[model samples]
Target: MAVHPLSALLSGLVLAASAAHANGDAPAGGEPAAAAQVAGLWCGDGLLHEFSLRLNQDGEQVEGELLRKGRVRSIEGRIDGQVLRTQSTKVGALVLEKQGEELRVTGGDGPIALARGTSFRRSPGATCAS
Candidate 1:
């Protein structure tokens, strides 16, 4: 069977994260890079449960290709102030949080919450706590 490119990339990212941990290298994001890119591609699988989302953010706008068991779907939303209001075309809307370098999608089809170390914020409208 052929490995999906996205899967391979996700796998590589996981390996790198693990290696960095073993080396005691403090991750740059320290929380998650995808949280703030605001205009880049992101993909991750929850440590527990079978959930993964590949999100892309553009300024205050966010949308991504959600993957479920080799199936790809779409999710879209926007960052409103400190809160993230989003909805999936297939699923629905969800509330998200931004803390440090991590942005967590709260109460949704993705996970109880899905978080990652992100490089930056979605846009200038939202700011992290001091």
Candidate 2:
């Protein structure tokens, strides 16, 4: 049986988030209040492709994953002032600026706009094995 592209991407993001929490990078219980504004899941619906992103911000350090059709890539970067700068294996370097509940990506193959979505979130007892 072949797994759906979205399923594989979600699985990869969950594993990455679990690892980050275990390594003391991501907050263990929940996202901190300070980072809540930029944390959680963001989704983008484009003409040709749809993308899902999970971002965990611990102070200035940001770690996350991006999932698109045929691709699952980890992203690492930091929040510099008002913008979040990250680099992905699939998309290269990108700059994200939050505008209300949306994130605007300017770099890589973007100008992509991702809106807040509830499909993915960090639970209190989330683990890699789950």
Per residue, candidate 1 scores C-alpha lDDT tens digits across 1-130 of: 9999999999999898888766645345544323334344333323412334455666678887555456777778776544456674545546666654445655554433333322223223332122
Local distance difference test, per candidate?
0.52, 0.60
Q: Which lDDT tens digits does candidate 2 get at residues 1-130?
A: 9999999999999998898777656576645323325677676534323666777888888888776774777888777544677764543567766656656664443333233221223323332112
Model 2: residues with Cα > 4 Å off, grouped in runs: 1-36, 88-90, 108-130
Query: Which pairs of residues collide in candidate 2?
Result: none
By summed lDDT, which 10 consecutive residues of candidate 1 come out lowest?
Answer: 119-128
Q: Which stretches of candidate 1 lie over 4 Å from their true place?
A: 1-49, 108-130
Q: Candidate 1, 12: how far from true, in Å?
A: 56
